[model samples]
Target: MKTMEQIRHLYSRAGFGLRFEDMRLVEQLSVKHSIDFLFRSSVQSKPLVSVKENVNYKDFLKDDQLSRKMFMMQQRQQEKDLNIEWLKNMSTGNTQLRDKMTLFWHNHFACRTLNAWYAQQLNNIQRDNALGNFRTLLLEVSKTPAMLQFLNNQQNRKGHPNENFAREVMELFTIGRGNYTEQDVKESARAFTGWGFNKDGVFAERKFLHDDGQKTFLGNTGNFTGEDIIDMLLAKKQTAHFICTKLYKYLVNEVPDAANVNAMADVFYNHKYEIKPLLEFVFNAKWFYNEKNTGNLIKSPVEFIVAMNRQFYIDYQNPDIQIQFQRALGQVLFYPPNVAGWPGGKNWIDSSSLMYRLSIPATVLNDGVIDFTGKTDPDDEAFIATARKEKKAVHTRVQTQPDWNKFLSDIPAHTTKKEIAQLVLSPAINSKLLSIINKATDIKTMVIELVSTPEYQLS
Candidate 1:
């Protein structure tokens, strides 16, 4: 049998932590088999279909402020719906690794758009390329309408080049900051001039608007197009190192081991930036399963909520309640805070956010309530506004009852609460919390008590 810690660590990294049935299944497999299973399952995955909302923008395109406002409001609601669909997939989809890696790439190439169609399309792009080669993913993302619009690349032209996309391509997406100079950004922008999409959300090139001139980028002088610039960037070893560092932090631990990152980069670069092999190398590494890496990173709001849903099979009668919970927890899907996306880790937790996070399991599983009326930071007012706009009662309550029979049946009859605790939590349970949990009368109460502890916050 796989050790409880080994199984827990596998689920924690491969996807969210396992439910009881998931644990039972994983217990039968060796670690290598488990990793291979996740990869194979994800590779065969299909794109997620977002729930369609029937809203005709043409009806509201009357060239008036009220019309524009109505259109925007409708789009915003549709975006929320799309987010709910993705959340549902993450919680229950068979291709768990695809969903997890899509989330990783979403933050990596963070771009926000109010258009629901663009948002849905962007999500598909992330999913499609989540396990593919990095070079192809980079090129596809750069050409997408949502990304071009978000970075103002559509405004770029031959004489007046907008450097926003080029700058981020290096600083945020590729080799990272300080690896390339400002001159490189300017030259790269020139090469990327006329890179835009048509109104039908199709990728189109405007040859007349493009600048065809020799430019020096990274000490190489050539008449480079946007594609050429991307090709050159991918050729650098720094790009591999930068990407590997991010993958390490996301999958392994927040504080990356430089040597491990460098080793992974070698494999990544040698294989021409294919993501699957890099992931395989990471999972196969001896250090990845080290005890020090377990429970080292804090769970982001999305991870926390999705894992809870996966474990308990949660659903909200009013879908808006799900959106409100996400907002209150500080991660509104399809609406990243900025271009850099959610900082995650320590940034995900604070006095207000942590209280909200801790209360989620109880609120959903036990019919507990939440109060939002209090003095708060200006930055958080947006979430409060989103909550207020919801037509349903804002106070917390369980809308859908959980099906616990499967989970209960999966556990052995002789298993104690301590053994259950070990399976549920990644970090070792604190003695004080364990003492309190040991007094619980039954398994249900024990679960609630275990999940509510601070230890549960670190997955």
Candidate 2:
């Protein structure tokens, strides 16, 4: 791959993206040096906004019904704020590798915590350990109140073991399905009894609730604690393969290649699940920049929105605009549809969603409105409909203003449309896109045309 294309690939997958100047600065570096710089630049995590103001759930229950209702209202808004804060960070934080890995783990260990405090806590865990060991990440995430509460491990007590946590730990988090059986789930649930959190969202154990009896799990017999069960799961080579396979799909291609996955599993397992080494291996491999892998993956909604902001310097005038766009696009941050998180890949686009996705660049840059009323498509005015709201149409005026002057002025006056298209798009501009780009009258028109194409939807 050319230097510019290589840097763009790294930035697109590892980080949200880079601006024209940012891309120019790194395009001269060798791929290895660029990878080093990317990792080095993201060594320190950017600060996250405080999403949890109140953690005293114990005291919260003592309050009257009205007090609880008011508190819940405040909490719900805080959750929304947390959602928007993360997006802004993704757009501007410069901690792309960490943030992107955190996003990967976010879905892998998916937990739909309704409480903002617990959700933020879990989010921190993912961010903090995004490049750390997988064993540590899994153990820490498993113990979080968000995971416990969401998976109902909070209710896993003696005599009545809740197997939801055990089942997901295998089926989703590690080893995948068919590696363990219903009996393993039952035994693991028994081991995890007494694992519950206090009102402060701290891990707490109810000794009386635990069953301290010999349990057989995955062919091992012992009085395994919840932590011990996690260790046992991690000890298996299959766990390494499961995580590497998912990582391969997330960072490389959605379709798994057995050879690549096997090599990844070797590096990941041999390193004792160290995240950095595994990623370094993947990034250093020549195949990572191959045509099939470079621009084939679909960008999630978060990625799509951040790319627009990072590339074009778009500003959202309204607080709820991101969430509204997320809802309309099918991938809302912090709100996974179910425990499996977003299906991703081809699931991100269908007949209805493709129309919305294709229209985002023009809609946001042109200050157009989006009508999420499950109605007709947007027209030439750059909106699904005008400000008029139907009886059931969810409407929001997308208060996005793109700084055309900021982006366009940076480019040299002599730059051609093809060069600009190369900078803006991950995929090489094809005949169709080249035709559209060539028809543009000016830089602003050319850029808008470049980004609005369907090819821009892919990385």
Candidate 3:
């Protein structure tokens, strides 16, 4: 039998944690076969549907502030709908690796837009290229309306270049900070001028707005276009190493293995930034299964909620509850805190957030109620104002109910409370928590207690 720990680790990193039925199936396969299965399944998954808004841009452009406000409100509603769809996919999508990698890339190439159409387009681009070539992904993202608007690249012109997009492309998205000079940022921004989108949400370059002058970037002199600059950046070995280090920290542990990352970087760079080969190398490495890496990372809000839904089959009668939960936990989908994206790891937890996290299982699974009022950060006045407009009061309760039969049916009769606890939680549970779980009268109570423990926060 595959060890429970190994199965848990595989599912935790490869996708969301597996359900009991999935675990039983996965235990039958060898580790190599399991990894292959995930990649193969991911390759075959379909793309998410694009957002279709009924608002007319021409009408909004006219001199009427009320019409513009209505358009903005429609976009906001569409964004929320997209968020709900994505959550549903993560909870039940057949292709787990695709969803997981899509999330990774979303944070990696973080951008936000008030235009819901552009947001959906960007999301689809990330999903389509999540397991594909990093170079292609990078280029596509740079040309998207959502990214252009978010980074202020639409304002870039021949004589006046905007450095926001160029600076972030290096510091946050690629080679990281300190690897490139400020002069390089200035030159790169010059090359990327005139990159903007039209009203139809299509990328349209304004020829007159582009610089078209010779520039020296990263020790190379040329009349480079935006694409040329991207190629130059990807040509550097530092870019490969930078991406590899991030992948290691995200997929393996917070503290990356230097030698392993170097090897992975070599593979990634040699393969022309194909993401699949690098993922294969990491998953196949024997060191990946080391105990030290298993539970070293804390679960982000998305991972925590998705994993719980995967196991318990939570069905929220109203989709707005998902948004409320995400807001309370401080990781709103598509709406990151800032340009740097969610810090993740330990940043996901504070005293207030932790208590809410711990209370989620009991509140959602047992009582089927969640009070949205006062749970969110009081400082988010914009969100508060929006909530009030939507009539989402403090007394709002989630009409959530768990399908316990689906959860319990997969647990074998011979499995003990401790064994079930091990299956549900990542890392080892503390003695006090274990004692509390052991005192439960049956499997249902044991599960609720186990999920309530701090150990459940790790994976």
In order, what lDDT does every prediction score?
0.82, 0.84, 0.84
TM-score, cand. 1? 0.93
Worst 10 residues of 2 by lDDT: 376-385
Candidate 1: segments with Cα more than 4 A from true spot: 1-4, 51-69, 374-394
Residue-level lDDT for 164 in candidate 2: 97
In terms of lDDT, model 3 sits at: 0.84
Candidate 3, residues 1-459, lDDT tens digits: the string is 235567678878989886778876777787887888888878765655647653446666975887777776676778789888898999987789899889888888878776677878888899999999999999999999999989999999999999999999999888889899999999999999999988777899998899999999999999999999999989999999999988887789888788999999999999999999999898888788898888778888988899888889999888777888888899888988788888887898998789889988888888555566566544345656875766344656667879999889988878777878877887876788778776889888888877887788886
Q: Who wins the lDDT comparison?
A: 3
C-alpha lDDT of candidate 2 relative to the true structure? 0.84
Note the residue pairs that clash in candidate 2: none
Candidate 1, residues 304-400, lDDT tens digits: the string is 8888888887766766666666777788787788888888878888888788777878777876567553423344456567778643434545475
